[model samples]
Target: MAWIMLLVAGLFEVVWAYSMKQSAGFTRLLPTLVTIVGMVISFVLLSAAMRSIPLGTAYTIWTGIGAVGAFLVGVAVLGEQVNTMRVIAAVLIVSGLVLMKLSAE
Candidate 1:
């Protein structure tokens, strides 16, 4: 349950990030509201997950999920360039996350 909450929090992190972009320096009311709400929910869930999960591990996983999700969103929606190094880096991050999960068990 904690892990699930963490994952949801991480997913919301991506949404908030995208919302921030759409907010355009907070000039847009709707997007700005979305960003604020998303941020609050994301942090609340993250804090709940941290109750059971180690802070270091939870933080790393949360950040990794958000970074990867955001990167993928950028690539898929924004047509961002994906070079060999970027792909390799992403693969490495995934590998590390998998290793961490495996070791935790």
Candidate 2:
């Protein structure tokens, strides 16, 4: 249950991050509102996950999920440039996350 909450929180982190970019530094109204709401929900879920998960592990996993999710969104939806370096970095981030997950006892 805690892990599920953490995953959802991470997904919300991606939502907020993408919405933030669309918000244009908060100049846009709807996207800005979405960003604010998503941010709040993500933080709330993260806090809830922390009740069971260790702070460092949960934070690292949450951020790793967000980073990977946002990067994929940028490439797929936002049409951001993708190159070998970007792919490699993303792979490294995911690999680190997997390692962390395995190491968490």
- Candidate maximizing lDDT: 2
Model 2 lDDT per residue over 1-105, tens place: 999999999999999999999999999999999999999999999999999888988999999999999999999999999999999999999999888878877
Query: Clashes in model 1: which pairs?
Result: none
Alpha-carbon runs more than 4 Å astray in model 1: none
Cα RMSD (Å) between model 2 and the true structure?
0.7
Q: Write candidate 1's Cα lDDT for 20-76 as tens digits.
A: 888999999999999999999999999999999888778888888888888898899
Q: Please list the C-alpha lDDT of all candidates, in the order they appear.
A: 0.89, 0.95
- Output the lDDT of residue 38, model 2: 94
Error of 2 at 24 (Å): 1.0
* Per-model TM-score versus the true fold: 0.93, 0.97
